[model samples]
Target: MRKAVSVLLAILLAVTGCAGPAERQDLAHVSYLTSFNTFGRDAYVYVAQEKGFFASRGIDVEITPGTGSVDVLKLVAAGRADFGVADFTATAITLAKERLPVTTIAAIHQKSLAAIVTLEGSGISKPADMVGRKIGDQPGSTNQVMFPVYAKAAGIDAGKVEFVPSAPPALPQLLAAGQVDGIGQFVVGTPLIEAAAKGRKAVVLPYGDLVPDLYGNALVVSKEFQGKAPDKVRSFTDALLEGLEYAITHPDEVGPILKKYQPTQDATVASAEVALMAPYVRPSGYSGRVGGMTEERVEKIIRTLVEARAIPDGVVLRPGDLATFG
Candidate 1:
């Protein structure tokens, strides 16, 4: 009887092993978080969620609303959340301070969507003409900081332009009211929609256009979590790659997807956003695949942040700071 019982226990263990992680009692429970506004590339999470991609991959993804990208990273690093998406600026600053050892696993957009936008009717046809104009923007967001960086590239004096801090919602009001001349926008978010809807013609100043290189948003994991759950990590990325392919091939379908979650997103604007984001979505490649990061590209972004004083000296980390699956 003793031998028989022992044999049965061994069989059960083997069954558990074959069942894989999903059937395990202590399966990894993933909690994902992202800021509310920066939801273009990030919204692919919803695509995976709604289309059953995460379920297919054995990931239990729970999303939490974020106040902003910078805050989202802080929560993830604190172990309050599993993972989050954020721009390179926030991660680099924290990494420079060595405050949190978060590593960026995958870069979603090869180039930054950060842009300088103005109406065509403003008579601000070129980047240089931005001087002395009233620019509607949040006081200390990425725009306020990077505004000068791009302005100088266009030979425009950054200080000459006046910045009026406006909430994302208020931007349209300010522009329509003719209170502010122009506002900066990401290719995915409010600015693009407003441009298309209200005939808010904008001169898009892609960060890549000026710098020929930039690092923007990415999926980041805590150093500790990444070390422990390499398999789950890979699974998460594989699923996102699948969703990205869907988005690229079915741009028409994305508007419906966006409308489902954010019903406020105009289908017309959403369609335009889908078009704008195609280059970043990588029709064939994704964060899980290779060529996502080049050696020179990493160096260029790191060096720019360092020069901007966004990072400080003494931390040994560089652009290759994260674990690369491909």
Candidate 2:
């Protein structure tokens, strides 16, 4: 009788495709850092959380707001955060300059959105106009870090332009108050900045217009995490990108979703930011797979940085050294 019962239990287990309770209950917990506050630009992580995308991949993600891309990169390198979303150019420069143990697992935006934004009557309609003017921004933000390169490309003397340090939330207000001539911001930030300006038109000088080859934000992970759990890294990246695709496609829905996580964020402004960001996420005529990148393009970016004096010429880097492709 006992042997018959044992055989029956074994048969039932096989039929049900059961695994050990421990194996079934185990889930990887990770902390994810966004490049900035809970703006629409960083809403996809919330989308992933709300849609159960991370949970479906056996991950429990704690999404935290980062101060800036450069700060996010530093935190990820220090292993304070398991993963981070940051600008590709900032990460590349840091990797070449400091050899931080970080790698980009996926590309978010195909083009750089960095820009110098100014209000009407600021007399800063063009890059050259920025010379001898004050530009306010977070000290280490992508826009501030890359300003010199943008200035050089636009035939402006970078040294003459003064960069005023301020918190991210204060920048738009600073510009509106006429405390600064311009602010370093991304192109998608137009709606929010314009709203702050209270009827003033924003004159945006986009960095991508002059430096076309540069890529934007990306998913970065520390080498330690990548080595310890490569499969988890891939799973997390897949889930995050899935959320990004959905967020960009459903901007209206994403606005409410971001508002749910960040009550301070205005849903309408969030929606507008996502709408403006859609074209950069999937550029026109780009047939490649989503989040996919190539070595040739990365190499070109490095060379561009070198030529622009963003990185030391003596420091050598390759795509494989900074990112994992395929």
Candidate 3:
């Protein structure tokens, strides 16, 4: 009788596909950092949390907003966060070269959205025209850090242009009010700029057009975290990839999810921001896989950074050294 009852319990556990009590208690706790606040730009992370994907994978993810891409990398490297989203160019060229001990696990934006924006009637119609213009941007903004590379590729002397630093929220307003000739902003910020412009039209010169093969944001993990918790890293990245795929297919459904996290975010604007970011999230000429990086792309970025003097020429980085895939 005892043997029969034990056999019955084992069969029931197998049929139900349940884990043992010990397995149930071993969920991994992960801390994730975003490059910026909870906006439409961070739709994937919001969706992942709202939909229970992270929980389903046994990862308790704590997502935090960041000041900027560089800050995200710093936080992860310093062990404040287990993983983070940051600009690939900055990570590869600046942070990696400085030996910050962070490795990119996935490339999120296959193409860069960084741009130089001006009013439609402004004389800065082309990249060459930006040589003598005064551009306003927040200190250490992505555009400011990358503008030299864009200028070098466009054959413009970066030294000729003057950069006026302002608070981030005031940058678009400075351009709209004619306090500055142009602003350095992301193409995804078009809606915000339009809203700030009130009625004026804006002209955007995308950096991708000038600098070929320029990459964008990526998911990064500190070397310590990667070594200490390889399985947890894989689970977190897989869940994020799933979230990104879902958000891409259900663009109409992400705004409300994002609004849940950022109450002040406009649903319509959030949806528009997601749409603007769609192409960059998975560019047509991409390597035909989600979150995949190639040696060619990394090499081009390093070469461009060298030409722009963003890093010393002697600095060398290999793709395998800075990236990993599971």
Which structure among the candidates has the greatest TM-score?
Answer: 2
Please report how far candidate 2 places residue 292 from its true position, in Å: 1.3
- What are the per-residue Cα lDDT tens digits for candidate 3 across 1-326? 99999999999989677566456567688899876566677778888888888879998888887656777877888999999987787676656456888899888888887889998888988988988889997666677778778888888898898999877667778998999999988788787777789978889999988775877778999999899888889899989978887787677888899888878777676777778888888877655677777777677777777777877667666777677754
Residue 288 accuracy (lDDT) in model 1: 35
Residue 263 miss distance in model 2 (angstroms) = 0.5
lDDT of 1 by residue, 1-326 (tens): 99999999999998877776546434456988764353454566677777878778778787765544456677788888888776655466655665675777776666666766666677777777777788887654556656655665666778898888787656656766678887766766654536544765556656557765665667777878888988898788777657766775676777678678877766556656656777764633445352155656677777776665455565555666743434
- Candidate 2, residues 128-198, lDDT tens digits: the string is 88888999989889888888778889988899999999898898899999999999888999999999988
Clashing pairs in 3: none
lDDT of 3 at 17: 72
**Distance from true location, Cα of 298 in model 1, Å:** 1.0
**Candidate 2, lDDT over the whole model:** 0.89
Top candidate, metric lDDT? 2
Q: Rate the local accuracy (lDDT) of all candidates.
A: 0.66, 0.89, 0.81
Worst 10 residues of 3 by lDDT: 18-27
Error of 1 at 165 (Å): 3.3
Better of 1 and 2 by lDDT: 2
> Which regions in candidate 1 have their CA more than 4 angstroms from the true location?
1-28, 35-41, 65-67, 156-162, 189-192, 195-197, 283-291, 307-317, 322-326
